[model samples]
Target: MYSWQNNEYEADGVTPKLSEAKRGPADPRLTQSNEDQLNVLLGAVVNYDKVIGDHTFNILAGVNRETIRNDNFSAFRRFFISNDIDYMFAGGDAEKDNGGAAWERARLNYFGRANYNYKGKYIAELLWRVDGSYMFPKDTRYGFFPGAMLGWVVSEEDFWKDNVPFVNYFKIRASYGQMGNDNVYYNDELQEYQYFSTYGFGTYIINDAMVKSLMESRVPNKFITWEVANNYNLGFDFQFMDGKFNAEIDLFKNSRESILWQRNASIPQSTGMSLPAENIGKVDNSGFDVSLGYRETFGELGFNVAINGGYAKNKIIFWDEAPGAPEWQKSTGRAINAGLYYNYAGVFRDQAEIDANTIDYSDITGNLRPGDMKYEDYDGDGKITPNDRVRRDMNNVPTFQGGINFGFNYKNFDLAILFQGATGAEQRVGTDESGAIGNFLLDFYENRWTLDNPSSEYPRITDRSDQYYSNNNTYWLRSSNYLRLKNVELGYNFSTTWLEKTGISSARIFLSGQNLLTWSKNKVLDPESSNALGHYYPQARIINSGIMVSF
Candidate 1:
């Protein structure tokens, strides 16, 4: 990089350099970062299959071993001799010392699976895995996980074919499985050996020579284990009208245990000592997915439509909460990633309303004035205080999200469109990095309450002048629900017979657009990222046309 800034002296017709050996006006810079990684993998597999009469069976077993090593180096320097020579060695002066690092990790695994079926009516599977990693102690370095699944084709029965002729097929499925996260810090002895007798060097002067000394970097916890998650799934699949229509729905629950927490939050700050991670928390998440589709060919034209939607919610099952905190302040059994917010009772209308109301937010913030916000006092202590602050159920995480897609083909031309949307989430908007605003938002300015516009929906322009609007409140939370046209494409395929003379077997030309439109209650930024801290970049709309040919 190179930049030149006109100095005060240069702008005033004087020499800018302060030293006799000063370099040219342009300040040249160079930076380099390099990474090298090597990996080795070895594995073996054995398979067996057999069929006798109406029964079938299959079995598979495998083992794998992997090793990885990585090295990284970075350096930066300035005051280059020439712009043509961009490397750091060409710099006239060194700005800092170069540094590099090296690290390694390895893992071993053994796995096996067995499957059986009776004709086409029933099926079952059994699986098991044993894994070992250098992140754990030798004695407890390995883990064993097993899982099983069963499925039945209820509509395949002979009786069903005779009783229900119109019904095509239906099947039910259920499965339970367990998995482990090797990267989670759930255990004190967690991760790729960051705690292993690591040492940092110190400098000392001995006999006029620089001497180096070593010291342990951190305390390591000896007892660590893998963070485990268990999952259960149940669902059904069905097809009717001779396979023209189909639908599938699945419900799932995932529970995670032995979650790594860096340190016990309840521990006193004075008692801290290079705290290591510990398995101190649990969480549960549950959700369901549904898909429905219809496909059919009417004469020479064919078309299909599909819609899919899903929702999920999670909660903190167990966590070490404070001893004497109120129920509202605790994290136990509450929604994950909940927001801190105060209740909104609309904007303060006027001084008469402020004097009549018992809610006082002055001590917490500065004096609350008319045209400012109003918050509810949950504790009802005659005045608003920390005790009055409450948690609003609004979370940035969406509980409902889905998409719909449809495509059709007529003759040699085709068209497709897709729409996506989400609801049940809140987006916080308005306000800059500093509590006191810099540039006012257009929305706040348009609806601001004034003496003449006392019925305005938004508080007055004084929002920049008071901390009352700075605190988290309903005034800042906006519904992020929105539906948008995500994608659209139109294409035409040339008849192969027509291109046969040209030596082209196939050809297609298409024009496509993405993020073309959106409908939302929150309009400042795209609802998808409306809750971000600062100004967020809205989704981009891209349009392109291209041709693909094959011979």
Candidate 2:
């Protein structure tokens, strides 16, 4: 059994104008203040097990609880003069308080497995688990996920007796199972809100409030169901060449249903709501994996090498949008991380071509003429607008990801090295959204258009007049696809025989380095940062040396 608990608190206040109000210590009247956040969590887990002749059974249960409290205080001072030549003084104070506690998410699981061997030639196993989560409704909170696998050793058969000199070990296996994830946040049963107010002379009144206003439907059918995923896998393992070479290949497909997503629902202005949470989509992911290993020994030196690679593709199988929306609005073919941009046509030639053609440059603001990107008019209306923006021709998935490792051993010393990389992912290079305001230094600002470089990739750095034309261009869009050295570590191990002479069973000293190097075409920042190219805390490169001993 295990148990844990934690608690935290914080307080803050500010009086900006107090120091400036007077030559001496400023008056405490004109000030703003707030105190927030008290949070706590507690949880426990317990396990039970039973053993049979050729099988093992186990059960595990756990519960988690949490609570939070928030409070704020604000005040303003004002002077009021009476008409009777007498001065009257008054003040008001405003305060808001909120607290929430939930006792939820108790989970119970039972697992059982049976293992048997018949003359060590054939092997079989069966396993099953029943899991429950508090986030689901009472009726559907529990489900059984079962899996079974069978393995056969062809070399163990009597037919291989005469071929024993050439045949070693060969096995085939297959499995299928179901898994669940519950990442839902907050309580669904109640509506939560935060209060704000202002203090005035003699009276404090509510100024404003915010609430998680969601449009709920009355067609309640499994509203809080679990997000379920089913997976099927098949593979084969082989060992030959005197056990010096081995390999395995696995193929799998996963189908997920009842996925929880934020569906855009139109709410009446009377309710002042715009969005709601609903289970309205389904997705599928499929992939294949291959691994190979080889080892050989020559005289006093030994060499070993391994390579692993995998590829996966994901697609939205089902999705629905609000009624009365356009077909494009209802379309959900791409993942959330997919990039949306205007297809780039070569720069226009001149103003005569711009005026001779009935092209609408609504999407292209600022100056009009040739030498700018000519976007494909999707609607064929002889004009370019927001409707012309479509999905760019780029990869939405990683083409391939994998790693390779090599090791060498001589006498009591061993050394190892690894190389890893990922390729074929599209990323947006520039800030396309105009309304957002924040940091921009991390963006590529070195190639701004100027008089000296009039034909620069970017537009002229004029005022807001041509802001629209300057906003969208190929100069800002760059291919995010890149291959990088993900990580690397090299280590050497000492012989245990030397440690045994010092009254120790084993001892070793090693040195390692991580994120040591990268090779890619990405120019602005580290290509491996994130899909959304933006400024973030720089990752650090680490190197260390350590020793381990056993007695």
lDDT against the true structure, per candidate, is: 0.79, 0.59
Which stretches of model 1 miss by more than 4 angstroms?
1-36, 71-100, 185-219, 297-303, 349-357, 409-413, 433-440, 449-457, 460-468, 490-513, 534-537, 542-551
Ten residues in sequence with the least summed lDDT for candidate 1: 1-10
lDDT of 1: 0.79
lDDT of 1 by residue, 412-500 (tens): 99999999999988878756543344466666667778778885256766444356666477777888899999999999999998999
lDDT of 2 at 371: 48
Evaluated at residue 145, the lDDT of candidate 2 is: 71
Candidate 2: stretches off by over 4 Å: 1-92, 95-121, 131-133, 160-167, 185-224, 262-278, 322-333, 346-358, 363-373, 392-399, 410-415, 432-443, 460-480, 486-513, 531-533, 539-551
Candidate with best lDDT: 1
How many clashes does the backbone of model 2 have? Answer: 5
